[model samples]
Target: MTLRACGLIIFRKLHEVSAAAVGDNIEYLLLQTSYGTHHWTPPKGHVDPGEDDLQTALRETQEEAGLDASQFTILEGFKKELNYTVKGKPKTVIYWLAKMKDNSAEIRLSSEHQAFRWLALNEACKLAGYKDMQTTFREAQQFLCSQA
Candidate 1:
């Protein structure tokens, strides 16, 4: 059986930045896991039985990053699914792009993650350290820029 997970690629747009420079002003939220390789990624977790994908994404985002549904707006038409293998098991992760309503909102981390950072696309890609994840960040940046 494939391991399924869901999460949100949460980001914040800096105020006062012009639309032409929107990409530079956007920042993505990444969390450093406390376990395993201590790798950095968006907040995600295995889906609980009986939970739908979006529900799991919302629940995990709240549980892992302390940002509830009310704190961010989910951007429609930007969901991304990634397929990869972990420990010889097939895994699939679904991610939706969300924009933070309040850029200054505090991020309270759960024990699962040791640290968190809001980084630009390049820095986020570096910390993420996965080709697929880096591609996702680039796609997201382009999507946001197109909307701007």
Candidate 2:
């Protein structure tokens, strides 16, 4: 059976693209798993018993990235789902678009992850390390651009 997971694609707006001023520019938040493969991705994990997908997304985002739905605005009409195999087992991930209102929102990590990054589109795709995840990043960028 395929595993199901859900998460948020959190981003902030930036003035310029300098590495030193990333926080000042819009960046996407991706976390590096402390577990197998040390893969970097948006805050996501297996869904829990009887939980709705959005609730699961919110919960995982909080647990993995320390941001709650209340702290960010979840853009309406935008959600991305990715399907792929991890360890040769079918897996599916659902991602919702969100923007951290404060931009400087503090992030607290759980044991599931050892590191985190706020990356631009290209950088994020490279760190994602999975074809399915890379496509998700592209779709997300298109969705955000359409909103403007």
Candidate 3:
């Protein structure tokens, strides 16, 4: 069976900028897991039995990043699904784009993560490790840029 997970690509605009320039102001959130390869990724976890994909995304974001649904505005048009193998099992991760409603909100990490960073597109992609994850960040950046 394929393992399924959901998450949000949470981003924040650092300062006022014109629509054409907004891309530079945006920063994406990434977390470094405390276990295994210690790879960095967005807040995500396995989907609960009865929870819908979006619900799981929201819950996992809260549990892993300490950011509740109310703290970010979900972008209506952006979502991505990545497929890969983990421990010899196929895993699928779904990610939705969200803009931070309040950039000042503190990021509180759970025990599952050792560190978190809000980074610009280039830095984020560099720390993301895997090619699939790097592509996801690129897609998210494109989506945000298109909206500007």
Best by lDDT: 1
Model 3 misplaced regions, further than 4 Å: none
RMSD of each: 0.7, 3.9, 0.7
Residue-level lDDT tens digits of model 2 in 1-148 = 9999988988887653555544335579999999888989898878999998999999999898888888999889988888878789998888898988887789999999999988988899999988878888888787766555
Query: Candidate 1 — what's its lDDT?
Result: 0.96
Model 2, poorest ten-residue lDDT window? 16-25
lDDT of each: 0.96, 0.85, 0.95
Question: Over the stretch 1-148, how does candidate 3's per-residue lDDT look in tens digits?
Answer: 9999999999999998898887799999999999998999999999999999999999999999999999999999889999999999999999999999999999999999999999999999999989999999999988888988
Q: lDDT per residue, candidate 1, 40-142, as tens digits? A: 9998999999999999999999999999999999998899999999999999999999999999999999999999999999999999999999999999999
**Cα misplacement distance, residue 75 of candidate 2 (Å):** 1.0
lDDT of candidate model 2 versus the reference: 0.85
